[model samples]
Target chain A: MKRKVFVASSIAAALAGCAKITNGLNEWQPAQPILNSAETLNQAIIGTRGTARLYRPGDVTLDYPVNSLDTPHQPEYLSLIESDFTTYRLPVGGLVDHPQTFTLRQLRALATLDQITRHDCVEGWSVVGAWRGLSLGSFLKLVRPKPEARYVVFYSYDHDQSGQQFYGSLNMAQAVHPQTMLALDLNGKPIDAAHGAPVRLRVPTQLGYKSTKWIRNIALVSNFKDIFGGQGGYWEDAGYAWYAGI
Target chain B: MDATAGSSAPLPRARSSEAGVVVRRHSLVTRTTHWVVFIAMIVLTMSGLQIFNAAPYLDASDKSDPARRVLSLDGRTTPAGSVGVTTILGHELTTTHLLGYTDDGQGGETARGFPGWITFPGYQDLAGGRRWHFFFGWVLVLAGAVYLIWGIGRGELSLLILRPSDLPKLWPMQAYYLRLRKEPPDHGKYNPLQKAGYTLVLFVLTPFVIVTGLVLAPGFDAVAQPIVWLLGGRQFARTWHFVAMLAFIGFFFGHVFLVVATGFVNNMRSMILGTYRLGKHEGTGP
Candidate 1:
């Protein structure tokens, strides 16, 4: 009881001086200043504590929409023209020794595998899809990233609700995980425009936001401080955790 | 098998009420856990509603769009009537100015489930709302663990569990609640309804929410995949989580109403001070 009272008093005292953790713009986040840092401390703890997670093999989705695709055009994406994307080149810049660009066909020609995994979203929904692509680890080896590169940022042609350019970032560790892929095919078929056509990043271990849907550039940087808005991803830029393992 | 099977003192249900005798009704541990769970429940509910507002509703599709939101709950937010529709019970809440779906104040429609008034942070940040929900999630989880461990250590948990004999008393308890009986059965501190409610909240609902919640977390996906498959799928699990929150809201309000209805001061005093007056109307003071 004494302990409880002490703890309660401490929390009450802390709350007495509450300030808005975030008052800027994020589409899906609450605008209430009272709720800004409410969960940030908690998320930080979870993010720091549970950095690694295991991926269990699961069956393919039994249905669609709820089971497969979550979005098509809600966040605006600029699809390169058929001819432009046919010869599309993904610029691999940032802290890399062998800065290179690979066309969609070249990326598809590399060693690849099909992975059927569940896509978990922070918005309280998930779906299973068979994603086929070249392993990010393999791609990283080809580019030969510099030792200083600690994070990977994927730029998207997609626009958020507020018309800002969409982007997502990941720790280099997650960026090169075996399950991480630059997906070109979904469910044994060439990826369509509705999805991130041509190619997209797929990191099964992270939330959907971390998996950037449009293929344009892969920048290996020491930190995301230099990226647009610098929150890591478009969602992260708003109010999401930079490392969304959960 | 029973940790404290022989150590617990039986509740004195038949103690005489002469001179308005008082009895030790609640233990310090139970009281603390109850209040902590109450606070956690409120935070979890509000944060949950905030998250739900982002999507506002659910739809199952194989070729689902890769957009932010294609469908939304329609209210006045949509044009005079733009075929915007959503449902809670069997009734479709498609009319303007309905609960959850409302005008975004910009001419354009937005399907935010609940207003800022009731949700945590009173804003649309799904990320922040999730953080708040998870913070209290651990509180609820830890408090529940302590309750199980301590309740079993003291053998008090058996008091809340439904027994075969409780079936026969169900009718009588309902009659008492309905005011059909003269007085409540000489229940030991907690009436039958209280026992049932407590048992459901502690044993059934709490575990259900925690397990379903675990399934929702991406980190637990591997370890809990089988459980997720068993429950159906990830979306099904989310739907269950939402349903459980509603059930919790119902339980919370019902619990409060009962406490207030059955002599609020006495009930509060028992949970707070440990000593409770002998009868429903034994003492004016708690």
Candidate 2:
């Protein structure tokens, strides 16, 4: 009888003790602050300061159009031949046999290729699009790297005024992959400025950011440690996983 | 001897007080179902942890080396065929690729299936998780159903579910509780707070967990498309599933505390044996 009483009282007391949050109405709150001020300021500058360029499929025409800004996805690929943006320059420097800058017409002069692939994002989203551009391998062949060159880094005109280059890197193995193309067209039409126009890197097997839209400069490096944030890409340096593969 | 008989009559009355009062509380079925839930909660929480450890969120230093390999996160090949993989600090590949498979004659190549045996340093593949999770899930659901049925039959459901009176009493009871000035509210089989929690777990959280889990079924996606859409998306469903796990963890600890607080031995015995010690009765006759 005593044991039974002890057990009943003890268990009841235990159940009662489980009620910890006496007030349940006010506990729910946001997990973290919505935005940081510094990040918002940086984003505002990057958003407004770029000239949009349009790129079309199978069109290898590159022009050096002097534009005030070169932001991503500017929907300017269609009116390229008529737009005030007339000149396009491909800057090739850093660890190369020939540090030569090429006109848009010069880039278009190379063998062009097109591929349809999916662009996956780390935030659990994807889109299928067609891309047209010169083979990065062919371009690398033009400006041969010295034996020490191990990685190719692409810099974009999309940058903060602070000279922090928005960049991405690829090992030589992937740079030479047959399908790797520097696309100037998207979705069977001229690449929209809202998308990377002029030219962008399309790496089918990786996430969207790896594609590095609105590319402006190419640098050959022996190692990746010297780059900003040293993680390989712009978004990567800003807390995104560098290899955001599906 | 006639005088001795009179003395014996008084002894019966004193004996009644010593024996204490008996309260018929939890039914046998209720007791059984409660234990089943207790066991299931323990197993589920432990297994869930093992699964979470398989894929953790990335940190800054995690972008360098060692950590990335351990986390099994690598870069996807771009359409350009460029493979830009990240090397995080502390992410070194010690184990061979365990989750990879090569497709067999379908559209693409298949890889080896996950090893069936339980071993450390091996990936906890979806197969193993599904096996244990599904098996225990059935047990949990069945036990819950039985509990509900038994509760209704015994009219214990009314006692366990909150009534209109419980709302007004909830605040005062809570204040008394926070101050530790009053013992637990004494009414029927369960207090208002206990009823509310159990009801929420049964009606809201558990059902959502079970339904979302079903949506993850491979071929069942087509059939469960409506549910998936209603929940926003598959990823959203997964997020809710994780959130539900947190709720269950809270419920589990709370349940244990209540068990220990309310006459541990007596409650445990009643749950296991379906009997409570008899106490003195002031007015009622047995």
TM-score of 2: 0.40
Q: How much does candidate 1 score in TM-score?
A: 0.73
TM-scores computed on chain B for all candidates: 0.80, 0.63
| Residue B181, candidate 1: alpha-carbon lDDT | 93
Q: What are the lDDT scores of the predictions, listed in order? A: 0.65, 0.53
**Error in Å for residue B226 of model 1:** 1.4
Model 1: what is its DockQ?
0.20
lDDT of 1 by residue, B1-286 (tens): 4221222453333343332565556777878988998888877887787777766664322212323232345444444544445664335656443354543323233456664545665556677777677767878878888988997877677767766666666678889889899765555444566677877887789889877776666655554557766766556666677778878889878988988997799779978876666774232111
Backbone-clash count (model 1): 22
RMSD of each: 9.5, 22.6
RMSD of 1: 9.5
